[model samples]
Target: MVRRANPAIQALKEETYIMSAVFDHGEFDHHEQIVFANDHQTGLKAIIGVHNSFLGPAAGGVRMAPYARMEDALTDVLRLSRGMSYKNALAGLPLGGGKTVLIGNPRTDKTPALMAALGRAIERLNGRYLAAEDVGMTLADMEQIATETSHVFGRDPKAGFGGEPSPMTALGVALSIRTCVRRVLGRDDLKGVRIGVQGAGAVGADLARQLGEAGAEVLVADVDPARAQAAASAAGGQVVGVGDILFADVDVLAPCALGAVLNDETIPALRTKIVCGAANNQLAEPRHGLALAQRGILYGPDYVVNAGGIINVAYEVSGTYDAAKVVEHVQRIPRTLEQIFEEAADEGLTPDVIADRMAQRLIGRS
Candidate 1:
């Protein structure tokens, strides 16, 4: 007999319908559900969002964080899964959306056994949902999970053996940023343009390096002082406090950190003309894109700019991984951004709307 639906999963299904009325195209099959488990000993709680399989399988990352409540984790998984859908669609990948979140701090709660158990739980999905690295996941952790299951990505050669996706992501973001700069600043080059990059993570550091190489004055900030210093030193950029990054006097603000950094609180303080980055779910809500446009900030949709890693992983999952193909896919960001910007301008619609329309077209074609 089939099991009864979990209350959390039922609530998520209801919430998705509510969100669809507002955002649209967030359809999910009945087979999709949020799986959860509580490990009192390891103090690990997780919610896995297995959203769709229309393209192939549902693929996304497993993030571990200290969520205040299970509802927070559930909401994040649903939203992130939806983003993954658009991300894969825009990148022309044959995969749907799914994401998993572990409720606990990664630094203290992440253990080998915990990851192994998570992998086992992933294995229970029977290849319908594939998990990989994300905000709180690392290559080593992925390696440990690989021991429990073979359904994970991130080990693809195209990922440079789990190296930073930042460069490729940066390449995409930089290309779009350069395009935005050209349209706004009337210059095709990024030389002498001041850029403030938030979060000195793998992606952020690589972005800073690329900006510096392009002769853009790069400034960086991160919560981790060591990482901030390292990125700053490597890129010959100045380091600033994490909270001070949004207020920097730069041509662009690259939020390479967590999502929802573009909410009302930070948006009013933003002094940049252009916003582009490798971060996912940059907007707290769909309406926030409109807010950014009203503020005259050229916001590059996070999924559009940060699809490099997914593109790389898709190539791997398809058994035809090629570095050149990956680069070609990454390079498409500028063209996509340009098209979205043009459409948004021509129709006087928000960028998020344009992106969703484009993604919906792809889904319909499929």
Candidate 2:
């Protein structure tokens, strides 16, 4: 029997209303799928959100986390899938938004057999949904899924054309940071800016390296102490604890960690002048972006800045992966950020609202 959702989960589900505006304007039908594994040892639960198929097949990432309730997973999948839809539209990919959330901790619950079972579940969905790496997932996990299914991304080393999306994503964030510095701090270069990066994963580490190369002081933190130390040492920066990153006294707080870090509680405590990174769904709610603006923080929209990965993946899936094309798209992030910020300032709205408007305009929904 499907369990009922508690109040907190219900509230998360309701948050999808903000995304509903774009979907309603586009007039796309949305589909939801839920899966439960019968394995006694590994009780895995998942929810897949297919927000639209107006363009082509639905594509997004599979996020795995230990949620306290099933409703939490459902809310995340729904919101993230909707974001993917907008992301595809803005990136000019012939794909719609879709996302899947495996309701368990990746640390202890993920197994080969369980992954295979999840692959079977994906196979059942057929071509309607394609999976890729997201929070709590890796390329190795995608490789495992490819053994059972073919509709996967991030497998083609050839598709990268000698450079993967991770670096491109970092580059996008770096460029946005530069733009933020110039606009918010009146500096044209990141020669000596101090940045506190909250995740030393692919995107965070890459951003840290880029910042260091550009002569920016970077402070890094990660749940894995070793990874944090390695990134900090390599970048010629200092390592801080994961919890201390949010309150770090730096010019920028780059959150490459999981989504929804900028909630009501964290928003009030942020100490950085700029908040920009490659993570998706950074805001716990739309109001958080407004709060950042109110606090004089230059906030870059997550979807706009993090679109480089999807742009690269789109080129790969289309069999026309070109480094120049990926670079062209990734480089546009700063311009997009500038436009969004300018529009937000002019219209007295949040960056996210302006970004959504731009995405809708690009997708022909506005």
Best by lDDT: 1
Model 2, 69-127: lDDT tens per residue?
A: 75566677767887888888766789877888887888887888777767777887888
Which lDDT tens digits does candidate 1 get at residues 1-366? 999999999999988874554333332333256677556665557877776666778888888889997557767887887778778888878998788888888898889888888888889888989886788888788878878898887763444453334456767877878988987788988889999999988789988888888889899999999999888888778999988999998999999998888888988888999999888888987889988988898988888888887777777677776778889988887888888989999999988899988986675533
The whole-model lDDT of each prediction reads 0.81, 0.80
Query: How many angstroms is residue 234 displaced in model 2 relative to the true structure, after the best TM-score fit?
Result: 1.6
Clashes per prediction?
0, 1
Q: 280, model 1: CA deviation in Å?
A: 1.5
| lDDT at position 24, candidate 2 | 54
Per-prediction TM-score to the true structure, in the order listed: 0.88, 0.85
